[model samples]
Target: MGLLDSLEGMAASAMTNSGSDQAKVAGGLMQALQEHPEGVQAILNGFQNNGMAGHVEQWASGALQTATPEQVQTGLGGTGLIEATAEKAGVSPQMAQTILATVMPMVISHFAPNGQAPEQSQFSGLAGQLLQKFL
Candidate 1:
């Protein structure tokens, strides 16, 4: 299998194992990217450089905690992120619960150097930008 293919299988397992909608999470990630495209890009780059599933899990859990069921379904469900998630290592929706089952303590401990949520926004401006750029 090629890279995307490998990513697809991993996403299948990750989503099945994760028990949540990949669309929602991916959408949320997009939203986050929209809000702070540069910051989100930087974070993704950091994750890539670190190549650590644990770190991805921590960040994903934090991002998903207060997320609603609608957010879960629309963002993660059937968005092909099931395959993409393996690339990130964090699970979605219910899988997030599974992935974080024993990781609560660790998630609480991580702090941004600036001590703030970088992608924090009520709306995803970067997502719009992405759509505009792609469309």
Candidate 2:
């Protein structure tokens, strides 16, 4: 199956297993990130360019600093990721921001372990692992 199809399946499975809004939003954000042309790099770059490189670095280094919703909105403001995630999760953009505040750090840490971003080829495997964790 295509990556999109796989992501849909994973998100559906997550919803089935947990039935939690957070899980659904996490899955949606994962889908959005995967579907982005730059994938997770765009997210990293967004934070980096928005003067939130410290936050991204902390997350990459396995620190557990939680992003505030406003921080999430600022870091991800123009990426269109938030809107995509909101649509996929069937949530309002504001709600997506709130959920993303909690989830984005984990996503970054998983995909960019030890302060390094994974190769694009590694994304599929890592995404599955991440989805499992969220579920």
Candidate 3:
């Protein structure tokens, strides 16, 4: 299944958890990434800036890197992207942070299936593709 399908499935199952509106959360994430065409690089930069270089490399390795919610928050802290996403999705910032913590690793891994980041053009299309699939 594709990213949207996987997110939809996760959203359906996570409804019981407060602040787990899967679709909106996923949309918020895509929205954040879309708003920043350089988001993938920004995210990696954030990780490096926050002293998470190992985690950063692991993510690009197409391997799942388990990062804590607090770590995600810190990683993205400099960029108001999460707050922007929270506003866009009408969700709380904390919830947005939580959702990103859970989903960002998956996104990175999926997009870098060959264990390497895609070119700029390919990266730019990711959010649009996710949104299209979402619709």
Candidate 4:
């Protein structure tokens, strides 16, 4: 199946299984990021400012460190961000937080396979591809 189909399956499975929120968060986060012109930088800055730079390095190195929902919430700057994701994902903010805790690391690792964050322009293109998959 195509990546979009795969992601749709994943989302459906999440909703079906009734615990994993990965797909919901992935879609919401991607949509939220796509809505921002400076999204890549803003996210990177959030990681940096929230002292999750080392975790970002883990994502860059493909180690995939687990970030807590609280951590994701803090990294992204709390309720406003969570609410935005919830609105996009059609889930609660708490669910958005849970989903982001999983999805964010995967996304960072996918975009930074070489252990360095991509440039904003490169990330934008890649992020668009990711967003498309979930849509």
Which numbered prediction scores highest in lDDT against the true structure? 2
RMSD vs true structure, all candidates: 14.2, 1.4, 6.4, 5.7
Q: Which candidate is the best by TM-score?
A: 2
Q: Candidate 3, residues 1-135: lDDT per residue as tens digits?
A: 554455344343333333445456666665565566565667767777888867767876767766787988888888877887787667899888887786677666655554455665675355545444334
Error of 4 at 58 (Å): 0.8
Model 1: per-residue Cα lDDT over 1-135, one tens digit each: 343343244333433444344433433333333333343434434433444334445445564243333433333334333234333444444653333222222222232322233343422332333223212
In angstroms, the error of model 4 at 52 is 1.5
* Reference-based TM-score of each model: 0.24, 0.92, 0.69, 0.69
Positional deviation of residue 113's Cα in model 1 after best superposition, in angstroms: 28
Candidate 3: misplaced stretches above 4 Å? 1-20, 112-117, 128-135
lDDT of each residue in 1-135, candidate 4, tens digit only? 543444444444444544335556666665566455555556666777888888878876888768898888777884255677688668898888887787777777767666456764565456556544444
Query: Which regions of candidate 2 fall more than 4 Å away from where they truly are?
Result: none
Worst 10 residues of 1 by lDDT: 104-113
Encode model 2's per-residue lDDT on 52-91: one tens digit a residue: 9999989988887789999998899999999999998888
lDDT of 3: 0.64
lDDT of each: 0.35, 0.85, 0.64, 0.65
Residue 132 local lDDT, model 2: 90
Residue 118, model 1: Cα distance from true site in angstroms:
19
